[model samples]
Target: MEDFALEHINDSRRTILITAQLADSWNDRIKEIAPDFTIELRPWAKAADIPDELWENVEILFTLGAFPTPEQAPNLRWVQLYSAGANQAFTGPLAKSNAIITTASGVHAVNIAEYVLTTMLTWFHRYHQFGSWKQEGHWPDEHGRDLFMPEELRGKTLNVVGYGSIGREVARLAKSFGMRIIAMEQRPDHRDRGFLFPDIGDPEGKLPDHYYTKDQFQQALAESDVVVAAVPLTPDTRGMFDATAFHAMKESALFINIARGDVCKEPDLIKALKEKEIAGAALDVFADEPLPDSSPFFGLPNVIMSPHISGMTPHYNDRVAMIFTENLRRYLKGEPLYNTVNKERGY
Candidate 1:
């Protein structure tokens, strides 16, 4: 097989579809990399809104949110997603399609990891308690100290479930606080997975004191002060944190879910919190978006919730562009793309 590369593009201009409106500067950047390619901009308002003819000849696609089937785009060869977690897009009929799929996996690691550390610090320092005191216009300095003593992250065991890009970033930050790390991953033996992003995550697999596989989930849960959920939402991970899983954790352990909400069953989490099975929880993503007004999580004093925006960053689009542009070059040459998804595993 002649390995694909830029030379294979030939003189004919190839069609590339971008489903989002980008600055004109990006056009120049793409041209600089592959001058023979022609770009088509189509902001993804609705998938069905796109004309049938537009999908007929698109060879490559850059999309933030939209999945067209192989039948819809006969000429489509590759898809570079603007978001992390392929989820529904990677599964279903598309999984069997000829088109290759890639995700923006490591792009959110830096921001999401920072959010995790911020929540941890806030919990440790009892910042929420201080806010309450301020609201009540009461200041009992010594009484406050006695009521809510501050704890240090140092020397604490931080367990990171799903040691992928996000988990690795959490471990990297946790290490800076002098915390001991124990992470669980699907493949513990293949510890060093390369990433496209720079200055993020534990590439060397040196941060965690030990790494465990699925069989040791209970053991990992039992030996930590803080447990961070960074796994994707897959069949195996759905409702993974059930009653039995909650019972395996230390009573004083703090739980943080930066991963999908379905990973932890809502009922099990509620029961654990109400019964004090664990100390506290900080959640970024949930089973349902815009968590309903009637949800009990809103009233939990020990819980902190964000509207699934932990990964938001000003440079998000720029980073996505970089990943897509790099992969586009690889695609032209017929080389392996970065962040290529494993549809079977659902990462």
Candidate 2:
């Protein structure tokens, strides 16, 4: 680790190369914060067209879109991705490289967690159906018993998959709502690492009474009343929650996904909902962006869908910018970056 830190500092004329499409304000902001660092904006150049001269001294690559192959930038050391998910970042040649990759993992945790809770509450209270009732002025036609909705979250179990920063935040908020929380994280020694949440008695502890390892993921899914997918997309996680996994869940369980849509197969989810294998689902991301109008999810009564806006809060850009700026400082000081993604895990 110390040798890695030294390598970054020893590099000459540390250039942080960024893609063209990023906002001018973002470029100006980076320059403002790290005036000594050479911030290069390379636009209109294909990955192969990246000038060999630019690669000579470039130490860090602040990537927004698909990264150039490592062979294209032989001297590249660190990659700071704009997106929280590092699936695309770890592919083919890039995956085989030794570059350190970090993501904006925790940047959207609070906002996305809030979105999950809001969607869950909406489903629990039947807000959309109630709105339809009011619009039709049909409330008086139904008896009180017929119109009453069943269940609340007070004692229900919320199983959070992939106990990263976002998962921890979701667990903390769920616990505050008097809901039982179960978390599944990747680390074998997660309890001792204190990364997602502190130990049970630690002041920073955010975990609930029960936590599960990768080996126990199936058990967690079986007992959950609400299953929240907060896991990152990786080779191992692609289509992780397929038809068989859905069948393992309780018939009345509500599923919420704030993670990548590709993590769950679209056809499998549609089939599960249509066959009543699961109670309902709220999805904020899709395998395809701007979910096609022909998609079956749009017409499903038991499905709640959004246009991948779970992480888009009022201050989203500001929050992302802050994280990037702080990371720039770390990059300059030869310090370890935050939210570093494991290349092998691809998250």
Candidate 3:
């Protein structure tokens, strides 16, 4: 088949295949941008639900789950991912395909950033202890000062391991609290362009006190009062936060992971927290989904575990639609797509 994107350069009619259910108004919203395009909406609960014929004609694929191979989608040209992380999508035939992949990287930044703040504030303000007191109907006269004193975020150092959309948003919010920020990214010199929501994060790159590359990651960890893992899962980043990285952190520093769970070895993190190598950790993602019921994280007092809900928000679908709309406009104009994943980097 001729390159579908190139073939559609002057054509207004195209085919968009989406897995997730969309409201009638949202469908209209998409049609408003590309009125001539035909859309096929399916539940996409299973990968095999999409028939070979459906894959053969789809020019654009919009989905959260179910990654179809290039062999299956012969006419596929672009993939608009509903998820921020593209680790799962970049596997098997999809990794080597000629189709362009764009992520909703900035879409979830707001909610994830808020989750990070909530996790940190919950620890610093001793909300967990207060909740326990409320449950027991016991009011402490000293406000649990002896047991837990409130710590302010002001003047504290925040080291963001990945300076992407989520990390930048975290830094933006942290800066408002008077916290100092440092960040590590694969390329500090490269600035992210083509974002529709510039107010959502540090688009100007002024939030971080310093920027460090991978070589200086350990140095970034050692100086932080709070360490946040917001990088993608790649060959170089898988198990990046091992025992050595954890041990390099300040004994009193708290760790927050809003990125992929596999970024840090679960056993290594458990050992670090158990040994008090790091003060505590709040994890939103895990190495395994529905993190096994027998997992020790459920019972750990110093650990705050959530079921991968950091990126969740009431407006998620709407935000995603906006990203898709912008990318669609670019696609019609034959412009470079936003959040284009570098296959070699695996982001």
TM-score of each: 0.93, 0.84, 0.92
- Show model 2 residue runs off by greater than 4 Å: 1-3, 6-12, 20-35, 41-52, 134-137, 188-205
The 10-residue segment of model 1 with minimum total lDDT is 1-10
Tell me how candidate 3 scores on lDDT: 0.83
Tens-place lDDT digits, model 2, residues 1-347: 11336364555586878753456788898998877678888753455666777876667776656466666677788877767777756566567667877776666777888888888898887775677668877674546645447578899999988777677777877787899988876565544221221221212434666877877777888999999998878777889899878998999999998888898998999999999999999999899888899999989988888898888876655555666677777766877666677655566
Local error of candidate 3 at 32, Å?
3.0
- Model 1 lDDT per residue over 1-347, tens place: 11233333342546788886666787678878777777878877455766777777677888876667778877777777888888856566467666777788888888999999999999998886788778889876785566568999999999999888888989999999999999886664635453447777877677889888888999889998999998888888999988998899999989999988899999999999989999899998888888998899998988988899999999888877878888777776667778777766666
- Give lDDT tens digits, candidate 3, residues 171-224: 989999999999986664636553558587887677789888888888888999
> Per-residue lDDT for 247 in model 3?
89
lDDT of 2: 0.75
Which model is ahead, 1 or 3, in terms of TM-score?
Answer: 1
Error of 3 at 176 (Å): 0.6
Question: Which 10 consecutive positions of candidate 2 have the poorest summed lDDT?
Answer: 194-203
Candidate with the larger lDDT of 1 and 2: 1
Considering every candidate listed, which one attains the maximal lDDT? 3
Question: Between prediction 2 and prediction 3, which has the larger TM-score?
Answer: 3
